[model samples]
Target chain A: MTTVPVRPPLVRSSDRIIAGVCAGLAEHLGWPVRMVRIGMAVAALAGGAGLVFYGWLWIMVPTADESAKRNARRPASPIAPAVSIAPAVSMPPNQSAAVGPSLWSDAYSPGYPSGPVAPPLGGPAAAGPVGYSSAANPAPSGPYVAGAPSQAEGTAAVPGTGAWFRVRNMRYGKEILLGAGLLLVAAILIARLLGVEVPLGTLIPAAAILGGAAIAWMQLDETRRAGLVDKTKADQAGGWARLAAGLALVVAGVLVMVSGSGSWEQTWLALLASVAVLGGVALVLLPWGLKFWRDLETERAGRVRETERAEIAAHLHDSVLQTLALIQRRAANEHDVVRLARAQERELRGWLFRDPARDAGQLSDRIKAAAAEVEDGLGNAVDVVSVGDTAMTDRHEALVQASREAMLNASRHGGGPVSVYLEVSDGGAEVFVKDRGSGFELHTVPADRLGVRESIIGRMKRHGGSAEINSSPDGTEVRLKLPAAAEDNGEGKS
Target chain B: MSTPALDGTAGDPGRTVRVVIVDDHAIFRSGLKADLDPRIEVVGEAGTVEQAIEVIGRTRPEVVLLDVHLPGGLGGGGREVIAGSAALRGTTKFLALSVSDAAEDVVAVIRAGARGYVTKTISGAEITDAVYRVAGGDAVFSPRLAGFVLDAFGTAPADIADDELDKLSARELEVMRLIARGYSYKEVAKELFISIKTVETHVSAVLRKLQLSSRHELTKWAAERRLL
Candidate 1:
């Protein structure tokens, strides 16, 4: 039996300190906030590798509201934001902050601080978030304010813009080498504080290993649509494997930091070896990285294409469209000339205004394509409109054919432009072919008119559909109705 | 602004109707203006949303032939031009003219305050008559516009122009259905056995309902924003 996952999504908590790195990590790993904090502090004191990891997580881990937005089905109750804190333990950091008295004080806080902190790396981190979260949120067991930052504070961050989803991937990245200068400063400051001669050679390898682990750590959570219920598996072995690989990197990094020597050549080799290890990790994540890159490239290409299209439109407006206006003005008294120019103008406008990638299979496209054929052959202008669309049914061909015939009948008899209105929904698809022609009596039409009877009515009836004709002196409208596919009804039940 | 060809006084049945043509293509605008009825005057012309607003403000034309897609004002196009002319809305009506039947674009403009929508393929005389009717403060529904009103209000989901925005009255539905069936306004009046003026009032009322309640409008506005 499948059970709902109670585990919180790995998002940086709304309540946080510094950048909420430790709090988010503690939250995801099910450890006391203080323990993760101490681990980070010790790592920081050792070689400043922790700050690089912290900085990376700060940039990568989405804040609480973003997490809530991504996995709407995580819970409606806002419980997912309650990252790390037990009623009996580690909330002393929050207690010390003196903000809102408890988690319940915040409007979106779904969990009352209770139960054990849970298993895994339990203790030492949850310290600083209590301070900043007090500004954005309110600390548990502190005086609550009526109007704190709350949800807005967490969601206010502007995500990166421009070529956000690129399609081109660099299998071997340039190695941005972020935080090297900061790593040096942090190392020197800590080395002096601890009164130990810091071995500068080992710093590079430790930083590389830590950076590599953080790179893999960023992929822990899945990104989904803004507002949809996601009910995927509670946990995947892949996630565990990544997490295990990350911890091994941390252990190996610390060991190298402890044992690394001061020789320049050996330090260079260690750096290369650590990079090789990272390359192996990157190889494991090649597919995911490739897809991510492709999205960014695709978005960038779409933007460039849009600019090019606008340029083409501007050029066309100056040339061909200007010429058409002359034709239109000169042909003002000529009905056919005016119609032809207007038709050409419409074609140009459609090309310029059509969406870059309109789905050809949509009912509107089908309706317009059929209408165009009639316009070209019969010299009758047709207005096609489709309001909403649905999945194509087995009866779709019958529906389109009947509509085409109706258009033909209207354009031929009416000697005027016809209007085709299509509405496709779960219930079914309905097409209305309206013509500005004089009335017709269905019975009086004489059975010799096989165009209406055999082509439209008969076709529809054979395909489990129906057709009705509404005729009056002003005009006539042929209505066609096709039921949605039989396969969809059962699928819709759940 | 173009001067009226024939100097006719206002309030006369045969008087000239001042109009604004707000289309992106200057060629199409001139073509349409050239083909219009002699009784209808092209008082103003604009090829973009900003220009439309400025020209409409300066000329105060009786009816504006608005294009649904144009080059300015947040890509709202005709909708934005109409929104920018909120002050002139009572005196100046909008009749949306589009080359395509993109439902969202048509519905968005209608919700923003277009009195009616007609495809660009409409004849010059029909557009001329439409202007005169709109000038007389009538909602001119081309057959396709009526069909759009029916489908959008009749049976789409909440996200796509369903009942939450506004539900049409039975009388309005009958009127729209008849129009969709290609009945002229006079014919619809006769079929419903009501006065022509009353029919106009009902059509205008349906438009008001589409963008009436702030509550109903918010959902639709949010949906439109999301789509864009």
Candidate 2:
């Protein structure tokens, strides 16, 4: 659904002629009377006389909201005469019956025999629900439709009228140019009447205004058909670019004001004063605009982060946690099961560890400290060896944590006195934790056991590695394998 | 290929189950095919998702024995091969094979729709057994995994009693059970994997858990409770 772009309505404070501007703007925006009056006063003073022109322009423009309301209150009048609507005959039935584009059809009839005049669509006190009908031949039957087609056939029909035709961008461009030219001519005539000398320089200001209008028109045209920016990037683009353009314009306007005034000393003083005031305003606005721009960028980043987090969380819950819960629920003895459970616990912690951007030194130190903590927490009479020369990257932390989890599991679950050997190979790192204990027959493990799921195995898998256990009744051996870092050749060579 | 002899049950429709093998190793697949009952039909074989999808589409086997590490392993590992195999997501039940019985690897395959997970070290008969169980929607895992699972799920609460404060230790526990069950002094030693004197010490602790006065009462209580 393409909606016509409407400017924000504000009361016109520069309305010295009457209170009509304030009343019209308030009606357009549906603002309260008191608020509209206050806004007119505040904006006229704060937004400068230039913004006062903006407010006045908004007051003069007929708001679409008002047109919509008026359209609702109008009587349901059929097309004045069906017979005169002959030109619509060649069109498809579906197109002929579809809704008209504008309130013009309901408000005033261009086909009326008496000639087009604004109808009292919405009187001051509009009571009751307004009925809206989209039927194409809605004007009442009379000479209006019958006689109207004959006259319009010889003359040009208004675009977006009757059955077809729409006011395209080209038409809009011409209308804007016509309106701006009229305004320029009016200003020139007014200056002549006031006995002010018309100079070549005077025309320059009008020409600049025309140039600004052309640029603004092109922008609106581009946005109308194809959005000027992606929806996510839209806010930032507007804020940053507008801020830069506004600052440049302020500088250019000051330069123009100075050169336009001929008295060197007076112009210099006036220009300095204006620059100081405008510069202060620009300074205040720059920060506010930049803040808005940054917020837009941050919002986009936040959305990406949230999506990634959800994916990670779902993976953890559906796969890893379920296994741990199963194991913990079915383990036969406290002594027999505690090791796997502890391994799973360590594994869960490792998977949950988030590495923020930090210096290599800080990250490695943190991992080393974490390793020491794991050792202290599990007091096993086992030989523990650490072999890795690479400074910790985020990836390395994940691998280290997985090995630590396996060690924890071996110490706690795999029966017997244990020993851990960490070795870095040419292409990968391997950590082996062996325990002398009774091993079970092959191919009888349960699927949902958590110790295997969460602690030793889960961590390794998450780090893109693997863990294997080789055990018989006499003993058990657990090995963890991880991808070796390029710099870890020194450590892994052994 | 000529059908191998031995277990003619493979050709019996009642015993035969349609199977699709998804391992990368042709040798392993051929070996599995050779040893299995002739009743079990090798419906289709594939080594990768594209091949798997093609074979599965044509054969639509009821069961798939998927290796956790295949050529072009998804995510560059075994678990990824299991979890990210979109070709095996529906219709067919999978039995995962891996050298690693790591809990995460097992969970990954299970979550990927494998009905069971077994280590590659499993014997041929056990693998055959697993296939049947997975086909029947019953789960199977290696013995180590079974112990892992059972221990994980079946932690018995430590039984503590008010009389346990009597300072009778674990040694006394062994002795009490043997004495209550009418075991002779030397016999109790063999049962406990300990010396007869150690069994005697544990019997005292067992007596203390009950706060019982005599062997006669302890034996009667143990007999009544069926602990003997």
Each prediction's Cα lDDT score? 0.63, 0.48
- Per-residue lDDT value at B28 in model 2: 82
Tens digits of per-residue lDDT for model 2, A441-466: 33565667666566677777877778
Off by over 4 Å in 1: A1-365, A423-429, A438-449, A463-465, A470-474, A481-494, B1-12, B23-25, B46-58, B67-77, B156-165, B215-228
Q: Which ten residues in a row have the lowest lDDT in candidate 2 chain A?
A: A124-133
The TM-scores that each candidate's chain B achieves against the reference are 0.82, 0.54
Ten-residue region with minimum lDDT total, candidate 2 chain B: B1-10
Candidate 1, after superposition: displacement of residue B6 in Å?
Answer: 23
**Can you give the DockQ of every candidate in the order shown?**
0.09, 0.01
**Which candidate has the highest lDDT of all?**
1
What TM-score against the true fold does each predicted structure earn? 0.51, 0.25
Tell me the tens digit of each residue's lDDT in model 1 across A194-271.
Answer: 998875567665765776577565433332211122334533455566677766677566656755654557656776
Tens-place lDDT per residue, model 1, B50-166, is 999999999999889999999988987888999999999699999888866655776778879887777776666567767777777767776666666766575432343545436
TM-score of model number 2: 0.25
Model 1 chain A worst lDDT window (10 residues): A119-128
Give the per-residue lDDT of model 2 (tens digit) for B1-228.
000001112112357789888777888888877766666789888777556656766777767777776666344333454454456555667777765444445444554556556655445655665566556554443333322222221212234762334233445433432332223345447557886445434433332233222334333322332100
